[model samples]
Target chain A: MLDTYKKYFRFLVKYRGMFVLFVLMLTVLGVINAINPYFYKLFVEALPEKNYQTILNILILYVGVNLLETGIDVIVYLLGDAVILRAARDVRERVFKKIQDLDFAYHMTNSSGSLISVLKRGDLAYFGMFHELNGLYRILVHLILMLVMFGAINGQIAWLMGASFVISAIASKYLLAYNLTTRKAFNKQEDNVSAVIVDNLINYETVKYFGKEVKEQRRLSKAFVLWIKTLWGFANSFRLIDIVIGLISAAGLWVVLHRTFTLYMSDVIQFSDFILILGFVTSF
Target chain B: MLDTYKKYFRFLVKYRGMFVLFVLMLTVLGVINAINPYFYKLFVEALPEKNYQTILNILILYVGVNLLETGIDVIVYLLGDAVILRAARDVRERVFKKIQDLDFAYHMTNSSGSLISVLKRGDLAYFGMFHELNGLYRILVHLILMLVMFGAINGQIAWLMGASFVISAIASKYLLAYNLTTRKAFNKQEDNVSAVIVDNLINYETVKYFGKEVKEQRRLSKAFVLWIKTLWGFANSFRLIDIVIGLISAAGLWVVLHRTFTLYMSDVIQFSDFILILGFVTSF
Candidate 1:
């Protein structure tokens, strides 16, 4: 997997300067996502003082900051497109060239139907991998920024949030792996189904002469049964993750809300701080 | 489009009882989504009183509601899978039969590469359409519930939200249509690229005899260039929508926050109400 990622990175760096700009823009977007909630805290704090001018100014600033965030997001999206699309094109071209260069014996041995399916999926996988990793990177930045803000308010509460995130991450790793396994099984079955269709189309004359349309449909129906079963397993795994992670997060939320409420009661924090904490946890 | 949806619904109703259960559970899930935030308002209200027992009870109740939501979500996912998977299988089987039952001349004219691609995409379209419609239904439920809550507080604010939603939806409809056009163009180019590859593999013997591997590579490169162009167009269309909608929402946010802040300053509502308004808007 590391080797695969290294090759992906190699393609990514084909537009080295643009890729750097994309990363920087993404980090800015993450900062914006994290800090926007802080403005709400500002609003809540300003409300008690009847500071009309200050409140209006904060609202204006809040909207200004949001507009700026949107601007950055636009740039990030464009940069992401420029980088990922070029890299994807490079990957596809290389894959096509490599396939063309393969030994004749290899081509003869491999069914073109399955080979084409693999090629198509490989093309899609490149795009999926880039976006997934890009999203993960942004999320990491947002998480760190949020934790820092949480720690600034109250260290124990931040610790509670961090611990819960760690537990959730650990659980997600296993659950997502299981999901991937089932998904891979389903993909294989899907490929078989497609292969059946492609093969049937390729041998249409023979099938027409043999009058085996019903037989072909029966064959596809059989493939559909197993395909459906694997798909259910894949779908069920997703819900399993949802249930387990949902409960875990609920527990975390309960503990955090309780801790913050206690802090508020003891006068360790103001009501604004309480609202901010609530906003952050719920939004996250 | 109506006929298409009618066909989809016909397939969906194959598992009549499960489909009804799925829709009911989905509605329940949407209510849960909309109502959960009211508990935050309750928390804020309780904080001012320092009502320890009430706060603890609310906390417990919040967690319990979340647990129930998660439980319902699990059931919904399972039911969705049962309904959608079976419906999709039926659709696929029917499409396969229809295709097989077509004239041999039709099969002769259509490249199997593109035909299989169309079949595969059609199969996927069913699943995608189901999920997209289900999500839209949930959003509709959540939005109605939220608007009612907002209206109960301030009719003007509710009107503002409703107007913003309408504007955003209108903008999204046009932008998404353009995005779809670009996406369809890209899909066509992608099919062309794959057709080149599949045709090359099918006609390998003639290519090998002619030593035309480099020519095949050139053909694929040409297809890749066009495919990349369409993809960039599609990606840019999405960003256009994002920028427009983001700014519109920011403007809406500014107006609502200012109005709510003014109301709070005038003693028309409590700090908790301010917090609740901020919470709802930001989270939504």
Candidate 2:
């Protein structure tokens, strides 16, 4: 099953050109996203300096960069879908067809909700995984640029920022994984509700013959109550992740800023450079 | 269904005493967690000044706070279980007893995995929700303290930080909701699979009588193929969340840090004071 990743990739191999182009577009978009903030610094520096020509140039470049980013992003978005949708649909088709060939007993033992969740998420998951890989690649580009900028300002600060980002990223991964366990537990219960409703529906004749309509209702309601609870569990895990990320981001923000703050105080960097560094890092 | 929240709270009414105590413990724990980092700032400040006595005092208080935190956490852990288990068991007992009075058809209609999953997560969900609420409360408290400290350092910086956190939290909420919609779609497929399997099992005799064993196997296999796809969706959504958080956190981290960087450059803050602010914000 783990190797299914390879299978998915192979299935998507035909879209490799699109995927590559998507990556290239994302890189360009990222460069633009990072650089756009520089306008703030440039505008500020020029405002007091009364450098009309500089401001005009900055305005033109800002518009130019935005246009470029928008164009690249549009293509990246389309190519992402092309790569993911085509592969996912292909995989789904193959698997579902295989299921059509399966026996009844196999369907009986397998849970419908679980199966559907697996199937429905297939294409999106493939798409998401590809998108995530591309996103990470863009972030890497952002990160490297950030590091280089920090290093330019102060090597010590760059080292600290790099360490902080890496360490936080790793730690957050483990934390997110832990939360995943709880999410899975909730998902299992959700599948159960599907199973119960399904099993009940399949035995409609038996239920009717036994005159157990009221009882079936009670059973279904009971499952629903539990389903609601598990649903909340699933929802709350996202909130926890949000909180965790908030804390981690705060930590990372603190580490890098504090270093730069110290450097600024020591007169290592001027106010303009500080603004530039600040703008650049924020681009990340 | 919305009343379910009221019902859960009403069910937990008996544990009100425990809940209040839990909050108190958490508030204390939150305070300790927030203040613990200040020891470093204190130590750093005192070190440069050769204030050995202050450093010793900070160390002693640090250890003492940690010890207090640990002790409180243990009790909180116990109270958490007591509160959640009592509520969940009460609910389960009520539901299961109802199942006992149900007709045989009712029992037959319900799938075991679905039933067990509901029962298993009931207690945990109850626990997780309560934990999440408590955590959010603690975060709120931490956030207030952070904002206050920032205000103390520089009101403008504090405002920007608060704004960044709020804006990002809101943005992330919408982003997550979009992902949840996709997640729910996969959940639907999972339910279908559960239904397929459970329905087949209930009509086991029908399949046997028809000598349609091969067909039954095919049917089940068909359901499984769908299940695999949904599983991928579920997996991919989590990955998407990871990527989104990575990007959003970067954005938030950037806004706040950049502001502080400018503050330092303008001589609004000293190097030591800068470190202190950095240490404090990270506690959030």
Cα lDDT tens digits, model 1, A1-284, are 57979988999888999999999989988888878678767976787788889988988887788898889999998998888888888887888778777878998887777777787788779989988998899879878988898899999999999999999999999998899999899989878887777788788888888899999999999988889999988999899898999989999998888999899889998777887787777667
Candidate 2 wrongly placed segments (more than 4 Å):
A1-8, A101-105, A111-113, A121-124, A201-213, A224-245, A280-284, B1-284
Lowest lDDT 10-residue stretch of candidate 1 chain A: A275-284
**Tens digit of per-residue lDDT, candidate 2, span A1-284:** 35966876788777778877877778877776666445544654554453446645654565455455545665666566657655665665566555555676786678654555345445446766776777778888888777776677688878887887877788778776767777677667656655564454445557667877678767666766766666556555555555555556556655665555556556786554555554554345
lDDT of 2 by residue, B125-199 (tens): 676667777788888878787788778878887888788777767866876677767766665554555455444
Query: Tens-digit lDDT track for model 1 on B125-181?
Result: 898999999989998898898889888888888898889889989998888889889
| CA error at residue A65 for candidate 1, angstroms | 2.6
Worst-scoring 10-residue span by lDDT in model 2 chain B: B112-121
Residue B3 in candidate 1, Cα distance off native in Å: 4.1
